[model samples]
Target: MLSPSSDSPADDVIRALADVADLVVVPHTRLADLTTLRIGGRPRALVECRAAEAVTAAVGALDAAGVPVLVLGGGSNLVVAGGDLDLVVVAVRNREIDYRTVEAGGAEAGGAEAGDGDTGPGGIVVRAGAGLTWDELVADTVARGYGGLECLSGIPGSVGATPVQNVGAYGVEVAQVLHRVRWFDRATGTDEWVSPGALGLAYRTSVLKNADRAVVLEVEFRLDAAGRSEPIRYAELAGRLGVTPGERTDPAVVRRTVLELRRGKGMVLDDDDEDTWSAGSFFTNPVVREGDLPTVRSRVADRLGVEQAEQMPAFPAAAGGVKLSAGWLIERAGFSKGHPSSSSPARLSTKHTLALTNRGSATADDVIALAREVRDGVRQAFGVELHPEPVWVGCSI
Candidate 1:
């Protein structure tokens, strides 16, 4: 289903990379087949790079030709457009896990990355290649009595994509333990290790997540070898574990609890559950100015009664802003879970209001249509504008 564009520059670029490495260069790979949302259209070219060198070569060639390239990892954090997409996709599939050099102690007090748990050494660290499944890495870490990543269990994506989005769950973000990332720099045609700060890791955003700024080859994480979890900070998780905030527990226990919680919310992907067929949360919580909080509150009061408005969820955040739950606002706006008609291909997850799902037959347009409907309805009912959480390729809401 490759569309005939004026230029087939991507094919020529991918060919050069294949010549240099063991890569599988294919044509007309559909984006819908790669993403969890099961939407999007076909890409002009798709190159599956199985090694770190292959990833660099492919991305480098595409950059030289000025062909737009989408770095595909787990394909879980993306929402692409329909029809023919004007880009090539370079999928990173190199994977390895080395826990040999870890230390027997806890992570450095503050936020310094811990060493590998290599009992015989100065420091040991757990090393995972970019293509490793995120949850699989979490499981391995927890199994070995390491902590740092327990709260991130069940997140759907690859290890490489985690740092790209500063992936976080249950009050823990990848920034807390990301030691370093080895990436291919398209601008300089050089590969090097860079710190998290260099990537601008903040609020579900990173330089790599922006596009093909760089293709991450591998990532290293520092974990506590003593097997204790990172200090629990989220209230719901802390309550479930029967611990107070800032308390640490066994990493395995935390991982289990987190996976269970994610499953209940349909955050964990399940083929049988149409509701789980989504790009996780569709909208991030809206952070509004403190003064605008009163405006949002009044809007809720005018729509629903004052009692319901008083019950609306709102949390104070830094810099005179308030974080309001997008789910709460959506539900209060009369769009409940499984909203609009269930007969449609796109619908809100029956278990979680924040997720928009594809019921087997949804096209990119169907999901987009539902997203717009919910987003517009919420904006009209409440004065706040909700932003989507996933990265979009050729579509916007």
Candidate 2:
């Protein structure tokens, strides 16, 4: 526990919260040390909550006192500004996992299920603390002969962030298997479980994103009982698995293949790989109105030859728009992999054009500068705007 010498309202709140069980306060901690981007300055204080109640209590106290609060988990999808920040960081560290068998008609078995038939005909529901690493939960289910999360393997972040960001990879979004979420409602001051419908899950975004409406305490995801993976929807993944699109495969194999693919693209974290030092896929695939697709394509055709323009990837978004590949637009706009130069502090990832990386010495300014250059270049070349996917704190591109 840390005690501040001053009598500031923020410091006083920290001192009072330190007395609460399962909560510890630290005087100094940097967002760079906590976030995947490894770029950001220090917050006024850091409150490490070891239990869900502590998270609610700490956040509630800070909120009531009119102090700014940042609910931090794995810090995988955040871009914090450099220099001393004015907010207090509530770090969620509680980790507990339970799996229950769902009886017919949506009934849950008494207590946590165990034994060979754990994955009954009605399927299994995994209840994981929000603080648990997202990949760890995926790995555990696969190890237990379960499925549904294999396509999402190799994604970095906490279980809580999955619903907040509606995290998806290889064509499987968290919305597909989400059972329910236990969240602490900031407005109501109540903790409750809500269905996926309440989340407003969309491509790489949710209502919980860019807002402090609620704090997720835990998450439950439904899994396949028969040990079969979700139908493969990503063309590259299905091709690698030697199966047609929408065909199912073994969960273990899916996990392995996804990991290999991610590593090759430098999406997986590795200390020695500077390419992995990125906030994974800096921009969301741009979604254009159905009526405007032709104009964008015409622009593409005019710049790059007609053959190359026709080869551009565009998927029909569920939300009534055509989702164009951000990476494709970036490359076609002339920002190649490792854009700018090898010596620049912030450059595009050598393996993937979508990821803007920090090469050991890049500041938030450097990363922001690169992002702006790429975004502006794409907009100028294709008449399409690329929006950043990560949540920005005290900064914007």
| Top of the candidates by lDDT | 2
Model 2, span 1-397: residue lDDT tens: 1233345588878889989999999888889989888898888899999899999999999999988898998888888888878889999888999988888657688664232222345888999999999999999999999999999998998998999989999989998988888899999999988888888988888899999999999988989988999999999999899999999999999999999999999999888999999999999999999999989989999998789889989889886899999999999999999999999999999999999998988888999999999999999999999999999988999
Summarize candidate 1's per-residue lDDT along 209-317 as a digit string, tens digits: 6676787888878777667798999999999999999999988889999989999999998889888999998998899998888788889999988998898888887
Tell me the whole-model lDDT of each prediction, alpha carbons only. 0.83, 0.90
C-alpha lDDT (0 to 100) for residue 117 of candidate 2: 23
Q: Which stretches of candidate 1 lie over 4 Å from their true place?
A: 1-7, 100-124
Model 2 clashing-pair count: 0
Query: Please, what is the TM-score per model?
Result: 0.91, 0.96
For candidate 2, which ten residues in a row score worst on lDDT? 112-121
